[model samples]
Target: MKELLYNLLHGSSTIVTPMDALQNMVIALILGVVVCITYRITYSGVAYSSKFNTALMMLSLITTMVMNILGTSLALSLGMVGALSIVRFRTAIKDPRDTTYIFWAISIGMGAGSSNYYIVIIGTLFIAATSIAFSFSFKKDNKYLVIVRGTNECIEAVRAALFSIYRPCKLRAETVTDDYTEIVYQIKLNNKDQLIDYENIKNIEGVSFVNMVARDGETLG
Candidate 1:
């Protein structure tokens, strides 16, 4: 048992044994799962890509493997660095936060690969906790999009309905033809209990159609 623990901690100089390699791989995988769960819960909208999430997990595993392969050889580590430089990534990350998560996952995987289990587990916990903490603000600013179609006279009558809510509303888009007028509004509410005055708007003089869509707080329609 002492010998097994010693191998895991100090890392092997010659070849990776079953116990050392398995322990690192398992740690990398568990941390990868933690990263994915944190991302799913904290990301504000449905715009997130599943493929990107998958990549994050794979990146962790790959990094762990790379560290295991390098072992204790400085020359091998330097060679691996040069080899990594030749690889090019074509994918573009739309969200900066995604990039941060990817970087974090890679770092965690590297630590695990190097058999630094304490750093891998503790660092993953810290970053995941920080991300989840930041997500609370987005939850408070719930966003909704409302599209109202009506005649000019109908729209004029409903102007008061927009201002009646205890929230901020911005006029996002307006389209008018000879027969019908359509207006789209972007609303931000401080609380979930504060509902929009949808019925009041629909009850206005010339309203032909009223539609409301609830979206992930970060997305705008």
Candidate 2:
């Protein structure tokens, strides 16, 4: 078992064998598959971009290939960097998490390609577990900004009504007008089932109208 493990880690350096190249390629392919699967399972965004996901998988495989070639020669490494630097990516990333995933995929590929298989496996597993933990935690603390617009006479009534239904709400901002008033609330709630309850608020006496919007922890304009 020790001999087998040593052979896998050190690799055969005497001759450039087809079997060795094939083994490296297979390892890279497996790493790519793992990355792709993890990304798919952990994704939480509103829309899932298959293109981006596919790009991540390909990046893992390609980066590993590049690292393998570069590992063989310093000259090739420099040339590879030059070639990659000239390539421009114009796509705009909406979520900050997407950028992190890109880096993770690249790291996995480079680690495996350089024959640091242990690092690649352990690092990927660690990152994946951390990401899943964070994702679930964020879901629990879901917050939203609520904007309420009504008449001056109804301002207090509005505040009282909102507080009665949704506890732990904070008044973020307020605007006074000749006939109407606009107030914003930073509300942290346990569930979204109470969202439609805002309609009852609009029915309050002296209230002209009530507008409630859901924001992901951002101030409502």
Candidate 3:
């Protein structure tokens, strides 16, 4: 058992040559670019971050380099795992889809590092196609958060105006005081034509103002 442990820690079965290392790095770079482009194309987040997108590609390259250096050495591989475990990411991932992209980038890097080009190429192409196709196939409905601030008197009228335009106008939040009232409603529309006629609610007697904002918090009007 001691002899086996010694061999496991000290020995490496696969020796990475300079040419092979170069090939792996090149493959990782190419696959990383593919993943980055795919992410940009299918991104549905509130903001498109060029820096984060660039980091995705860099992650692939770094992962591949790590794998190549570790090469068949059990001890170094274990140490690498320990080192990685200490790292903490503070950035909040708002969109769940971003996690999938991150995993995809890491997978590509690992595959390239191990010279599994067949699986890497085929899997990447399939995933990219699936992402693109799914993005196009199921269109996202236009969703808006309608914020109405006004006197308590026209609250019902404001609701009526919302329900008249949006079929399923959902009341998300409401703040009511002695004379002031603020109501937030979530509405989904198929197109701009279906958008609420703000004048209808604003024209009400007690309504102070009506504001429409997209799901991403961008004010529409």
Candidate 4:
């Protein structure tokens, strides 16, 4: 077993040495952790999925393993490809940012597995730094799913109040009752002054209830 490992790592007719493989994989793991951290910091609660987040780390690890195995062997590469062909994935990612992170994880793994420590270290650092910077720089839109119950005539008054306070809003749902009407609006606000909006809606005549619920980036539809 030792001899086989030695050959795989050292006695190979390849550019990567035993030390190189070890360093590569170790760096891959480190970079994988970095990627995970970056994802955690940058992730918005919108459509949050713990499983998908965990898969980013796995993606880095597996890609590293695959690249290491295929290092200098065309035949092994073909076999790996054939083996991987049988695997299937059906889960849909709701966020495009998630896909970008997944691809970044795989790229980090591939670079590390091939003993490109510079690429792994520099690229991972750059991406992670960028993520951190962006997290601080760009804020997610202050979107809210506002639900209101009032008389039919009161809706227009409420809408006018909302329009003045918030940017254009999309009406997601509405229901009419004998005595009152319920309306849901997806609105984005420039400020986090939700209390003011609620107060405005409540002050409207015929308005019975006003609820403003913060929402993560899920579509209004």
Candidate 5:
């Protein structure tokens, strides 16, 4: 059993030539860009992160390099597994679309590293086309959490202003204190341009503040 394990670990591995390594890396880079661009094009989130987008691109390159190195040796592959097992990723993925992009980047890297050009090319094109189609077909409404703070006397006025400017406004929360009232509304807009009336809402009399925060579509209600 010991001898078999040793032999398995030290087995004859595929040799990677310099030209092959360069080709794999270049392909991975190109695929990474495609993945990044696809994510950017289909993304409909308030928190559009450039850092995460750049990470997606780099992740493909790094995965390709790791796979290339691992392909050349069985013992090193085992070691890499052990090393990676010790690392912990604490970052949270706020959107499911971002998770899809992450997986796509990794898959592209693996395919490129294994020199599966046809599968990578065809699969990428199909996935990108599908994503674009869905993005256009079922458009999403832009959502915002509108917070209004004002004196008790302005409660009616605040409601009037919100209802006049934004329709279908759902009240998320309402807190009435002895001196003031705080109202939170979840408003949906067909386009982001509809939020341009913020200054008008802020200028209302007795209104302490009017703040709008871009938010996801999900709600507890």
Candidate 6:
């Protein structure tokens, strides 16, 4: 019984058994499932791509399979790196959060593929917990980005009124024309709903038009 238990625990390196390979594949599959679910639940961006999420699961499995093959030979490791280096990614990822998910999927795959099952499980749980904690603890601020196009007559008054309501205001850009001017301002507000009060600003003595955009910016949309 002692010899049998010892062989079971220490047999991975010497064992070319189908069971061992199947075990590794199963671990990779479980890790991929976890990664896919986490990516789905924690996603908060403007546009969610099911295709990208599916890719994350497939990447986890692919990384695991590659690592398993590379583990058997040093020559394969160098060749694999060369082969992977030749591949170029041309997709433009506009959202930083998407990049984070990609990295997380890769990390989990690498960990499980190398037989570090404990690390993969523990690390993923820690990350998921931290993300949930941060989501509840952090409150998104109310802010607006204002773009104005008008004659030069009431530009100063508009700026003054904006500065009075918003705490930190920045003049992003300005373009002057023969008869009109285009101005953009990054404005943070005490109350987001208060932006409705600014409709009258356009009706002000010489204001042309006032446009308000949420400060969250564009993401993956």
Highest lDDT among the candidates is held by which one? 3
- Give lDDT tens digits, candidate 5, residues 83-138: 99999999998787788899999998889888989999899989999998899999
TM-score of 3: 0.85
Off by over 4 Å in 2: 1-21, 90-94, 137-139, 151-153, 191-193, 204-221
Candidate 6 off by > 4 Å? 1-19, 40-47, 93-97, 154-157, 160-172, 198-209, 214-216, 219-221
RMSD of 3: 2.5
TM-score to true structure, per model: 0.72, 0.73, 0.85, 0.72, 0.83, 0.71
Model 2 worst lDDT window (10 residues): 212-221
Off by over 4 Å in 4: 1-19, 153-180, 184-193, 196-221
lDDT (tens digit, per residue) of candidate 1 on 1-221: 98876665555455878899999999999999999899888876557778878888999999999888888866576688899899998988777888899899899888998888887798899988888888875544467787889998778666567767735788889999999999888776665444535656777778987876776433322
Model 3 segments beyond 4 Å from truth?
A: 1-3, 170-172, 194-196, 199-206, 216-218
lDDT of 4: 0.79
TM-score of 5: 0.83
Candidate whose TM-score is highest: 3
Clashes of each: 0, 0, 0, 0, 0, 0
Per-residue CA lDDT of model 2 for 1-221, tens digit only, reads: 98876564445433324665566667767776776777787786557888888898788888877776666554565577899899998989888989998998889778877778888888888887887777767754456677777778888988987898787889999999898888888776666567667668778787765555554333322
* Error of model 6, residue 108, in angstroms: 1.7
Worst 10 residues of 5 by lDDT: 212-221
- On the 0 to 100 scale, the lDDT of residue 128 in model 6 is 71
Give the lDDT of residue 188 in candidate 6: 70
| Per-residue lDDT of model 6, residues 66-97, tens digit only | 77776655456668889999999999998887
> Global lDDT for candidate 6?
0.74
Report the alpha-carbon TM-score of model 6 versus the true structure. Answer: 0.71
Worst 10 residues of 6 by lDDT: 8-17
